[model samples]
Target: MRILLTNDDGIQAHGLRVLYKAFREAGHDVHCVAPVTEQSAVGHAVTIALPLRVKEFKENGFRGHGVYGTPVDCVKLALSALLYEKPDLVVSGINAGANVGVDLLYSGTVSAATEGAFMGFPALAISYDDFNHEGLTGEHGSYVANLVERLPLDNLPHKCVLNLNFPNRPVAECRELRICRHTSAMWEDWYDQRHDPRGRPYYWLTGVIPPEKVSADTDRALLTAGHVTLTPLRFDFTDYDLIQSLGGSLE
Candidate 1:
């Protein structure tokens, strides 16, 4: 299968490079178009007011185009201008951090795959639970590539995204992949206010979901339990039940 590979962790990220090699060795044609620098948590932002720049990167037999813009921008630019043909699949990440629950709302990693789905292609976003890259290896990428090679891409619903998250442990240690749902839980977020050299206050964002809030059968809980989690997501944002109730009342 032809694949468009991208990530929010920048083009030169180890996880992205590992995935590139894995896909190539698996015999799937892969193209990498990703951010020139880390663009994590930027969500689905696009460069509307500024001209985007693309630079080709080739090193140690790995090649990819790096975009000086958001992860979503790379996918849009690649499909609209770079590639000679549309890809069969758009895969993002092998991200350093997990994208689960509300993290998906603020994740550039998942947003990249979401952009690919918007273009009517089968898309996937892969992430690891560990942020510091502890215990990560090529086997994780190979495992995911093997799964992608077997997925029924042609039959996937339009505008659907398969969000895959692997546990921090090695592939051999993971309890098989489990299909799950994202939790509706919100993060207990807070801002850390501090002073700069000039005595100006700056706020740094930090948060976590309380353990009691995560339930079993959801992506977060399963991943914490050392299982790979796959959650199918759709772009349709309509609250149909609410819409139906207010349909004629507002009319």
Candidate 2:
């Protein structure tokens, strides 16, 4: 299958390089168009006013492009300008950190794949839970790459995107992948107030310690237990149940 790869991390990220190599080695036609600089937490934002730039290159026997825009811009440009035809699939990430819980709201990685889904393509956003985890070299990248190659794309739901999160453990220690739900979790926020050398006030954002809830089916809980969590995400955010309860109040 022809796969278009992208990430929130910049074009030079180790995660992107490793995943690109793996896709090539697996004999799939892979094309890349990622941000020129890191665009993490930019959400599903696209470049609207400014002109976008695309730079084509070849590295490690893989042909790819770099985009001077957000992750959503990369997807839009690849579909409209770069590829002669739409790719079979769009895969985003191998991200630097996990996009779980409400964090998905701010993830550029998820946004890229979500953009593809909006355009009627199968999309996936893969991330590792560890922030400091390095590239998919030797066994690490290979294992995840192989699993991705074998994913049951043919049976995927329509208008849905997959959000995959792997445990932070070594590849060998990883258990089987688990289909799970997005955790009903949220960050306990805090701020550190301080004065600068000139006595100006500033605040540094921070979070309180996360507590383990009793839920048996959350992406975080699964990952914490060494499972690869696969959560199917949909664009529809409506509260349908509530809508029915308030049916036609004026009537």
Task: Sum up the clashes in candidate 1.
Answer: 0
Please identify model 2 stretches exceeding 4 Å from their true place.
60-62, 135-138, 248-251
Residue-wise lDDT of candidate 2 within 201-240, one digit each (tens)? 9999877327565266888888888888889998788999
Compared with the true structure, all predictions reach lDDT values of 0.92, 0.83
Which sections of candidate 1 miss by over 4 Å?
Answer: 247-251
The alpha-carbon deviation from the true structure for residue 110 of candidate 2, after best TM-score superposition, in angstroms, is 0.9
Worst 10 residues of 2 by lDDT: 207-216
Top model number, lDDT = 1
Q: Please provide TM-scores, in order, for all candidate models, with all chains considered together.
A: 0.96, 0.91
Clashes of each: 0, 1
Tens-digit lDDT track for model 1 on 1-251? 88999999999988898899999999989999999999998998999999999999988989899999999999999999999989999999889999999687899999999999999899999999988875679898899889997888999999999999999898999998899899887899999999999999999999898879999879999999999999999867789999888987999
For all predictions, the C-alpha RMSD in Å is 1.3, 2.1
Predicted structure with the largest TM-score when compared to the true one: 1
